[model samples]
Target: MSEPLVVPEVRRLGPARLTAGMDRWDRLDFAAHRRTHGPLPRASRSELLAVADRIDLRGRGGAAFPFARKARATLGAAERSGRAPVLVVNGAEGEPPSVKDATLLARAPHLVLDGVTLAALAFGAAEVVVAVASGSAAELSVPAAIAERGRDPVPMRTLCVPDRFVSGESGALIRAVNGRAALPPSRPVRAAEGGRGGVSGRPTLLCNAETWAQLALAARLGPDAFAVVGTPDEPGTLLVTVNRSPRPPVVVEVPAGASLAVVLDACGVDPGAGVLVGGYHGAWLPPHLAPDLPLSRTGLAAAGGTLGAASVVALPRGVCALAEITAVAGWLADESTGQCGPCRRGLPETVDALRALSRGAGSASAVRRAAALGRGRGACAHPDGVARFVLSALTVFAEDIATHASGSGCGLSSGLTLPLPRQAGERLAVDWARCAGHGLCASLAPDLITLDPHGFPLLRENANLAPWQRPQARRAVARCPALALRIGR
Candidate 1:
């Protein structure tokens, strides 16, 4: 694979929390980590819960779920059911634009491991798992950190899985670790509830890589000290990935209530155009609002966006907003798991509609219909997220849409600025040169395979079958009388 056009740099603002000592390039070995951050603070289960409640630390992952509540529930479930709880440090870093988790694992692996060890001690877990995306730098860094620790009370292990977009979801991670397909299950179940019998049928305490780091810091600093830097409701530092056009992105740790504009400026990003906060699944906000908005979740929520994964992609001038949206929409459609009807069908339809609008041949009604078809209809949030992103693009760039719809092009060519995965999922293929067009594949997996005008089987556009869909797709391939159907990467 070609190297990324823009690689992200890492830094810290105010006092560093998880990013301490990152600038030195020295791996915080076990001794150094202890010296820098004090001894690994030990806390009882109740004390850990109390500290989490007081600090109001939320998961650093995109969900931003309350950490205290999740911890309490997981502990409660384990106790009630008499099942041991397993601690999982999720360093999958599935979102292409985000780099905080990988940064932590690379520069300060011991801090993260300390956090995991602390959590395991609190939960009385016999084993702890640190899951990194396969082939990531963290895949090597984390295991080395574990080996550096030698023997511990709770054994720690590292597991690497394929780096797909949805594979980082909590349920999907659990499912993947349990030797199942790394796709979200049809039925929603919390890992804390012993969902799908997580990692040997035990209750799981899953937290984002940064969340574990924060817990370790909070245990060392106590609630009041941690609250000194951030807001009242949400206190502590945030790791933000800033992607400015024409420049590589950078990950910076800033206080929660820091001014968004200041953070962007410090990262040398020109927010004069618009900004896509969070990752691709997050919202687009007007650049003018950056100065006044706080970096906290509540503040971003009031501004009609989220601090999702704390990723900020600056939209530069001279690019057509509609064109950019079209590119991102097409990418999202291709990334869908294809398990649910809404995502499999609605996302591609939405992409086509957006493309039509960019060419001045589509109506707003068509785009709206496509968005509605996908919203709230999928087993996972993939469809809903796509709908939200597309709808927001339509609303935020209404003037641009109007101009494009009137046949006056936005005067800019489509240059995709957002980062997407370099590798695409495997797609279904047909051997048209070898055999007759029987259309058996279409009959076997109608959702994934469709009939072309020539009665030959054509894999549906953007139809990258999910784990659940593979069975039928394989069946269709096997049943092809002409021996023409196959899957290709």
Candidate 2:
């Protein structure tokens, strides 16, 4: 049976800057938005960069890259190229453990759009394109918001992209804006340099929904006001997706250095087994340390966890954590774009080894080996993120690993607790004993397959294939000459 997610509720530690009027209303239209957030402030490149640096403004996307650095790079590129810059609003919230970006975009879109407008003005951007996941509430609301401000000063429009996990990548979003396949390009150019030449080959600036909303807040409130609530180093309120199953993940706003335990407790989660600090790409915190850790990046890092996208998940004591990790590892393998070997081959192989460890059927060394194989090897950071998540589980649940490895099992069942869209039980695996290395499957589906050094196929296991890649995956499966490749669910 599938684990069901409860509908999420928007929560806060106190009155918020970004989520200003969200408590009284579900969403803000143009009139309400204007009333709630007064007028959007204008900013120069120097002024914006100064404010960003003073407040330590960073991208809310996984990397948490410094916004001022990216802004300067994009602005510098635009000047050198003598071409007007373009701005992309990344609202494609592909991270399964996260709902913060979508929540902000759906509830307070004007805040995000205001940030976009401010960024456009500072960069002298000729055009601005908003990217939202197809079928998401933001898809409808964003365009409507654009229509509301009919005579757009910067020529804004919406592009509904595939709602797949990788579709939110900066390169992928850029490609979708440029009228191409919504997949990350093999050699992804920085958005600073137009990122696959976005919107008619000009330099581009891209940031997620939360990043933009935060920017708007930073501009409205100077560094001192912004610094009031958060810790000294990390200032401002943050939106987090707290997963306490049977109830969907709650999208809550908390002060920068708030107590992690309190947030999880508010969401009715018991951080007994382990707590996943940052979504699937994040690390698992040991039970003892879970409650005491702070929600800031430095705080979590000290506890051997990452505040990646702030997707906090608390694992209940009842479930087998190893089983949960294995299942999630398997799902993450399925979510890979298969753009390179580490993602296609390494990720699935890592999950297999992890599963073996979970069941006491394999050595801890094996899990370590498979998980580490993809380090610094992916075309993107997807494989590395998966590796971090799996490895952390191994450390946090070492006692369980030893218990399971004894050929005796814990009494707990492997029932799901974390929220995953689907395909945790499926995989694409290669049976080495069954065949010769013909490499035909790779030829059949280059988009989804690649050849290893020995000419063996490296591809997604039981790929919950993307809409466009399914046909290719099927064709490759049918054409495998050695029949070594098989997908099982």
RMSD to truth, every model: 3.6, 4.9
Steric overlap count per candidate:
0, 5
Cα deviation at 293, candidate 1, in Å, is 1.6
Candidate 2 — which residues are off by over 4 angstroms? 1-7, 195-199, 423-473, 476-489
Q: In angstroms, how far off is 240's CA in candidate 2?
A: 0.9
lDDT of 2 at 385: 88
Global local distance difference test of model 2: 0.81
Model 1 residue 226 CA deviation (Å) reads 0.8
Give the Å error, residue 52, model 1: 0.6
lDDT of 2 at 356: 68
Please give the distance, in angstroms, between residue 124's alpha carbon in candidate 2 and its true position after superposition. 0.8
* TM-scores, each model vs. reference: 0.90, 0.88
Q: Give the TM-score of candidate 2.
A: 0.88
